[model samples]
Target: EGLEELSKHCFDYAVIDEVHHAQAPSYRKVLARLNASFVLGLTATPERTDGVDAVALFDDILAWQATIGDGINEGSLVPFHYVGLKDDVDFQQIPWRNGHFDIAVLEQRVENSARMAKLWMAWRMHFGSRTIVFCCSQRHALFTRNWLRDRGVKAAAVFAGTGSDPRGESLRALVSGKLDAICAVDLFNEGVDLPDVDRVVMLRPTESKIVFLQQLGRGLRAAENKSRLIIIDFIGTPAIRTSDHSSPLIARRRMQ
Candidate 1:
């Protein structure tokens, strides 16, 4: 019924989230079905490995942006300390990219190991008061809760596996200052507001500009004048090269 009803409704205003994914046959078909006078796309990495594909969809690209490096160098955003991917991690074994997750490997690495556990401890020592850890999997989320509890830090994790009621409760606790840090896969991404998340520990890295912006946006919100959003890039390297194919499109927002 959900699919039937959705098919019948003629969308007047279409907002394509992570529009870069639109190139896929599924997303493209959905975009084609919609009949709208205005189409709004939101993506961090608009360019595919094949190259930019968004030019054909929109009459004009309303705006565009720079990477985390550019923002920091320009003083528009805060400087971040990029941490090593951990000594235990073997770069050759994992398939690293800018826009996806290694669910199986990442889950094990975050859970049954001291690497991430140790990093969490360090993250707590520096910014334990108000922090957010972006885990890469459900197992990671579960493991993080136990790991923090053992260390005597008031930490909690909220994810889809927590059931509807409990998930809501955990988020409430975090917002009300009941939890020191929160870890989850999809909960804290774009649009899920938690203004107090000053410390961002990125256990996952995506090439998508939208995902990075959304995850970073979580900590950027006003937070008692936090010493800027402290982002710990767990994954080494710049994830992807966004500048090579980018155009000259500009936004109207003031940086200062």
Candidate 2:
């Protein structure tokens, strides 16, 4: 209804934020109907996992590109200290197809008690005022949150279907220091500003570079007294394959 109302009139300018998602069917439909004199698309991530070129939608015009290193150098984002810990999970045993692992199998492989204990130990060793744990699924997130809470840590889980009220409250609590950590799925991956997060814990293996960067960017936002972001990444042997070297994190690991 909103789109229909807006479509009745032509606009002089149209701006689409998070334009990386413009390749989706809904976004494409809106773009096809938008009668704008000029359009501008903005996004931190231009790469798409579906092999579609988002930039080509803008008539192949190149505008600007900036990397994480650029943001850190310019003081817009804090530098990061990354620690890659070995994960005993055998990812090769999980089914991989179409550039992604079978999520159900992946979740089963990661959501075990021993793995959770290892994650808790890592977080305890490098504790921070605020932290976000990226999980493979809602079940994984809930399990992690429960595990943290049982240990007397103020934690909450947020994912899709966790309604706006509770999600908002949880985010507010984290920002206000009432909550120490949030175990989340892809809910915090993009379009969320969490400047106060000083630490990021990755419990799931990231297959896409875009996702890896987005997750890393969650804690990179500059905040008062935040000198640097600490990343505790659990990695399976297959995660560091040669194809993964294109990621900045992997590049940094190679240098180290």
Q: Estimate each model's TM-score.
A: 0.66, 0.88
Best by lDDT: 2
- Per-residue alpha-carbon lDDT of candidate 1 for residues 1-256, written as tens digits (9 for 90 to 100): 4444567777668788877777788777776666676778886556654565765677656656566456545664554433334435543456554534456765554455567665765575556356777776667776776787777767777777643226677777777778777777777675476766667776664555455556766765554554456666555444542343222212221111
C-alpha lDDT of residue 57 in model 1: 71
lDDT at 231 for candidate 2?
87
Q: Local error of candidate 1 at 210, Å?
A: 6.6
Each model's number of backbone clashes? Answer: 6, 0
True-structure RMSD for candidate 2: 3.0
Ten residues in sequence with the least summed lDDT for candidate 2 = 247-256
lDDT of 2 by residue, 56-93 (tens): 99998867777777778799988887767778899989
Q: In terms of TM-score, which candidate is strongest? A: 2
List residue ranges in candidate 1 displaced over 4 A.
Answer: 1-18, 24-30, 47-52, 63-86, 94-113, 162-165, 204-214, 222-224, 235-256
Q: In candidate 2, how many clashes are counted? A: 0
Candidate 1's C-alpha lDDT? 0.61
